[model samples]
Target: MFTSRMFAAGAAGFALAAMGPAGTAHALHSDTFAADNAESAAVVSAQIADTGSLDGDCTGTAIAPHWVLTARHCIEPFPTPGGSVRLGQGDQQRRVQVDHWEAAPAGDIALLHTVEDMGLASYPTVSDTVPGLGAARLYGWSPDGSGKTTKLPVAEGEITELLDMSLFEGKQMINVDTHNGGKTQPGDSGGPLFVDGKVVGTLSASLGDDKDGMSDVAAYAVVAEQYDWVMETISGGGQGADAGTPGRGDLNAAWLVGGGGGVLVAIGASVVVLRGRGKSDAG
Candidate 1:
């Protein structure tokens, strides 16, 4: 279901492995974040870490004052005990502590309960129905090829496919085409896909055919499919019982890569390489 290699961005080694943009046209749009709550609302740059070191970066969305939504792979295997989310940018940019975490039972979705209110003017809500196949947009925090993080990049994507389940994790997914003209590179995992101004999915993985790791299509975990889990997890209250302090643990995660052969099911994101001393081997 994937190309020879599926490189994920955001993680330390992931950005280099995933290469750069594939299309000629730049898909960045500043107006996408111009709405109220703008800066902190997007839940930019989540630096997940344990007691050892910083794991990696992932994009997230502040759905509530104390809750941020992201891909489970960003904090899986061993839950992140402590981390910070970048709110606003430039002079206004500030890091807020993430005190707790909760992962969905069956999907790539997860929640990061922050210690402070995100201060979003208009928090984006999850959609109820399936996203109609058409125009859509995606937002994430990625580097600008120089290892320097870019201002939240918003790309114009098209919802081309809706599947009963994902090729990686068996969870419901949506295929967004950003190829030929615009594409998602590294550091985009856990990003949010906006369809009709509502959050429909979270960026899970990308599929490409080239060698640079530039992806023509992106797979998103359907938010509507995981709506109940997200709401219940958040409503259940403090930390969902699994949240705990950061501890020392080894992170050896794997991503599925395929080409013209058999398929493989990945229970985590397509790229889960940790960002510490060096790149860890795929589990």
Candidate 2:
């Protein structure tokens, strides 16, 4: 099942520790205001449920006025109805209802529509440039259920080795290292990894023995390579807003290192990851 990590592990700390060699330790987590804090906080605080009860915390990003990007498994029906995506981290008053959801079951990506238009202070866009071998930051929420409120915090890290295309079956994924002892957990799936203010990838999976401390092995869904597909889906047709701007990184090289003969799962686009067992539900 898709589950959220607790605060005991320090969401930010776990992410940093798992970042491995390429990541750098930074004080970003201690900053008063985080990158995209207002929006991310809203998403972290919002309640998510698939059936009569809560299923798990789902992380999301504002790609457009009304669309949120998340993992397809979070909303997939598994003998039960899926949960909904909530925006606005700390503001309890701003709750937007989901109007609809679209996902490529084979790719593990999903887009959500809200009842009202949401104005983003900062919207994450794909950059044609990829960061060199170094640490960067990935932001999202960690659900601890410690008190009446849940918080989504931003964490920093560095870019590890960019995997090859063969690492993934279809979609693009990159490995990263975190700093400040932070890491991604189950609920962080679909979050955005920003480098120099540009979004390079989406949080997909992490390597960890337990729920607290995430392992050094972490992967993200590359957005640049999928810009065409994302634009096509978001635009409604071949003629909508253009979200296909490329980043600076070499996607072809990254793919060759990340993707090889990895296991390919059908979820929206084909998500290729290292062979493993724990196939948790997307939610």
Q: Model 1 reaches what TM-score against the true structure?
A: 0.69
Q: Write the residue-wise lDDT of candidate 1 on 137-164 in tens digits.
A: 7776643212224345456788988755
Q: Candidate 1, which segments miss by more than 4 Å at Cα? A: 1-40, 50-56, 144-147, 167-170, 237-283
lDDT of 1 at 128: 64
TM-score of every candidate relative to the true structure:
0.69, 0.62
Per-residue lDDT tens digits for candidate 2, residues 30-123, read: 2322444433432432123333123234556766555666555445433332344555545542556665666553444556666566655545
- Top candidate on lDDT is 1
